[model samples]
Target chain A: MEFVVFIIAGLLAIIGALGLIGFKNPVHSALSLVLSLFAVAVLFLNQDAQFLAAVQVIVYAGAIVVLFLFVIMLLGVDQAEDLSVEPIAGQRPIALAIGAGVLALSVLFISVAADGGATGQQSVTAEKVDSITGTAQSATAALGDNQTDGTETIPNIEQLGRTLFTDYVFAFEVTALLLTIAVVGAVMLARKPKGELAPLPVIPGRSGTTDETEELEDA
Target chain B: MELTSTWYLVLAAILFALGATGLLVRRNPLIMFMCVELMLNAVNLTFVTFGNDLNDLGGEISVFFVLVVAAAEVVIGLAIIVAIMRRRNEATADDLSALRG
Candidate 1:
């Protein structure tokens, strides 16, 4: 049953991602992206990364995509019109070749990795514990002693929070600072000036003479 | 072959490729933004898969940060897009080449 859920979530994510690219309308694309992000969060939940899943929903699906929609609406840039002339003449071939190359490389990597049988159930659990604790030695030791069954043990949220707050505190604080800066910058950029100001006169010394000369000439 | 988590990951990869292709091929800024989001979600899927495989909570925490950053990006990105549209009167990415050297 759990495996079925994972399959469904993965399918949803893939479909949503495809829709994001397939749709021409920005709103539709954003909606598709939202769906994809949500599906990913579900996948995280299935992985027993409950905190991550919740954050994924709250941040990516809820805030980020909504911001994209807001921008689209504000700009009124979603009109169905082709903005650029097709084939700027020189760049299309290069772009296509590069894209194809990337795709080929990705496929090759995936195939090679898959052939190595890297998807066994045991290694994943061990990797997860090591990542969370930031020490492979302890986790490996624990795994050696606790080898009761083949089923992987899922770590609890409390352990996760403790690890994050303790070992990764500085990184978390830095992230917070970065977020604060982003918020401030966004607000400043979004705010419009009340009105345009007159241009300041250049050549301060000549300004008065030039104005007097102009008046005398007109008289 | 039997259906496994790896199969799901492969599907995610295919989806990611589709999204990347769309971004590369499409000229629409909105569509491009959506495609970028699709790619980000694909990465998220990989994180979750690895997380599940390892049975650890760190993946979840990282995903949380990704989500938060994504949200902040959307808000600011939209504002900038709107500003650009108001100035240009057209939202097509072709007109956004003012900075192109």
Candidate 2:
């Protein structure tokens, strides 16, 4: 059942992504991107990362894509000319060959790696616990308690928050600073210019050309 | 019928490839930006899949960071686009060759 849910979510995400790439209109593409982001958030929720999933929905689907739409609307670029540049005739074959070669090499690597013995599935679960808790102490406590009760225990959001504020505070502050810089930069870039670069050109028949026009008419 | 999570990863990879191709081929800046977003979401899907597959929370946390960064990128990217559109009426990526300055 969980696997089925994952499959559905993945399929929806892929379909939305396809739409995002295939759509010619910017607004439609942004909407499809939203759908894809939402699907990924659902997958995050299924992974037991409730807080992350909520943040995903809020940040990606709610805020970011809406910003894109707003800019698209504001710019009023509805009549965009199609400007897809096809690869030069000779370059296409070379590019295709390189891509194929890379794919083949990756396939060969994966096949060889898959044949190796699965030495560390259990270790992965252990490592997952440590990384999720963001500390050895909490993970140990969680595991110790779980082992005593013979039940699986997942760390909740509060523990995650504690770690974020305590150990990861510097990183969090850095992210905040980066966001502030981005916002300020965006605002500055989007600000209207105070002056024109050049004076408007005087039209031949307009803009105080009436005397000349009358003389020409009389002649 | 049990489908493996690897199948989802494969699908995500295909979507990512499509988005990358669009980004490379499309000369419209807006479409390129949209394709970039598509690629990011594809990566997010892959992260979520691995999170579930490994029963790991870190992957999801990473996804959160990815979302935040992607949002920031879109905001700044759109601002840049608006600036470019204002300076030059054209939004085609090819016209941006003025960046050679």
Candidate 3:
């Protein structure tokens, strides 16, 4: 059952990525990206990174992609891009060659890893044993019965939160600062230039209705 | 055969390659931005896979930071793109060759 699910999710992810590249319309590509992101989130769930999966869906698919679409619509740049123009000479051929090389190298490295040693499950089990032993001693010393066992391991979210707040506190706080600066910068960049004159109140003298004139003025 | 971390890592690498290709192939700035997001997602997958493989929370925590950074990047990047598009009526990256000497 798990294998079947993995296969399905992986297929969806790859298909979505292909669609992202294949589609001519930017809106279609954005939608395809959402599909890819959601599929990856499912894979994350399968890997037991529930928190990361939820964050991936909420922040990435929900917020960031939505922002992309909003910009697309606002700019009215949704028209299909002209494919014939190679504005940058010889870019596509080079990109394709490099992309192929990267894929080959990555696959080769993975195959050569650890002499085709233990499967993922074996490595995970071994790591779990090591962690349990290592944490049992320290965690037991600090928190007594809060110690974790193999079967009763702390949930991924809880572990993530504990680590973020304690071990990675500085990095987490820096992320908050970064987000604040980004928000400020985005607002500054997206806002209309301050010196631009506000549209005059619709003096209904000339052509179309008050609404049309207001629209014209705004434009 | 059972699925393993290697499988996920390989899948991520493929996705990353596709993203890089798309970034280079697509001339539209918006599409290139989407490709960048794709690459970031691939990296996120790798981090989670390693976190699971190592039985440690460090990878996951790093993923959180990456997410934050990605979000920040998206906002700033899109804002820049929109500003450029508004001035020029299109967002093709190749057309923005003002810096070309």
Computed on alpha carbons, the lDDT of every model, listed in order, comes to 0.64, 0.66, 0.79
Decreasing lDDT order of the candidates: 3, 2, 1
Candidate 1 CAPRI classification by DockQ: acceptable
Q: Considering lDDT, which of the candidate structures 1 and 3 is the better prediction for this target?
A: 3
Q: Model 1, residue B47: displacement in angstroms?
A: 1.9
A6-78 per-residue lDDT for model 1 (tens digits): 7788778777876775666778878888888787777767666666777778877777777777777777766
Q: Tell me, by TM-score, which candidate is best.
A: 3
For model 2 chain A, the run of ten residues with the poorest summed lDDT: A198-207
lDDT of 1 by residue, B18-46 (tens): 67777777777777777777777777777
Kindly report which residue stretches of model 2 are placed more than 4 angstroms away from their true locations once superposed: A80-155, A196-219, B1-5, B51-56
Docking class of 3: acceptable
Better of 1 and 2 by TM-score: 2
Candidate 2 docking quality: incorrect, acceptable, medium or high? acceptable
Work out the TM-score per prediction: 0.75, 0.76, 0.84
Clashing pairs in 3: none
Ranking by DockQ: 3, 2, 1
lDDT of 3 by residue, A1-219 (tens): 767877899889998888888788999999999999999999899888888899999999999999999998998878887677777789889999998898899889877873455645556655666666554223223444443553455466665666566656787788889999999999888776544443323223223344544555686
Clashing pairs in 2: none
Lowest-sum lDDT 10-residue window in model 1 chain B = B92-101
